[model samples]
Target: MHLIIMRHGEAGWHTNDQQRELTETGRRDVADVAAHLAESPYRPRAIWCSPLLRAQQTAAIVAEVINCPIEEKSFITPDDDPGLCLDALLEQPPASPLLIVSHMPLVGALATLLVDAHRRGLPFMPGEAVVLDMPVVGPGCADMKTQFLP
Candidate 1:
């Protein structure tokens, strides 16, 4: 199984709440990312996204291109721990590819955790994604496959 972790696109911090929607640039960037995924060999079977507006919007666009159902997971919350989210995802492993649309620290932290279990950190840029191949029998056990940014 392949897990694709993506960070939400650029957002406006001057908005009402942290859940502020994505900017026009953000939308464009996500659209380009979606188009790339649509034409690429890697496609997601299921997509999990944070409830935040920005993250949801990004997932929605990607879903349109990939034609996959989106599952809103609270584990991607800003305050939520990435380790917990990773555990939950591993618990209910998807048969096909899985895409996760989330915020910075969580996305970054998840990538770092997958690459180096001892490292409790997230170092991902916005709109960046990391792909991992994992064994079905042994959950949480993954091998880094590829990483992409758009």
Candidate 2:
């Protein structure tokens, strides 16, 4: 299975973190990255997005460019457990690569959990993405394939 883990684009400040929205620059950056991904072999067939506004917006942009379906996931929020996310991913169909658009700590932690068997959060800039290839969805079972920075 191929997991394309992505951090949401830069977001403007909001009283509620879940309500934050992407900035103009964030939109542009994500668009550029999505365009490139659409033309690359790494384009995703489906997207799993965080319910948070910023993540949803990022997923929408990628879906528009790649013409794929997006499903909102409650387990991928910033503070959600990466282990739970992994378990949820195991329940998904593995016919094609899946793109996950989520927040900082979760995205980073998930990447490390899959690739290094640790929950230590890796640093990810806004609109950044990394591809991991896993024969089985388990801790440290995946190999980093490529990275995308918007």
Top candidate, metric TM-score: 2
- Per-model TM-score versus the true fold: 0.88, 0.96
lDDT of 1 by residue, 42-149 (tens): 788889999999999989989998899999998886667777876786677664678889987777677677666644765766777778777642324677787777
Clashing residue pairs found in predicted model 1? 108-122, 109-122
Candidate 1's displacement at residue 91, Å, is 2.3
- lDDT by residue for model 2 (19-88), tens: 9999999999999889888887889999999999999999999999999999998999999999999998
For every candidate, C-alpha RMSD to the true structure in Å: 2.0, 1.0
Question: What is the RMSD, in Å, between candidate 1 and the native fold over all Cα?
Answer: 2.0
What C-alpha lDDT, on a 0 to 100 scale, does residue 90 get in candidate 1?
60
> Pairing residues by index, what is the TM-score of model 1?
0.88
Model 1 segments beyond 4 Å from truth?
136-140
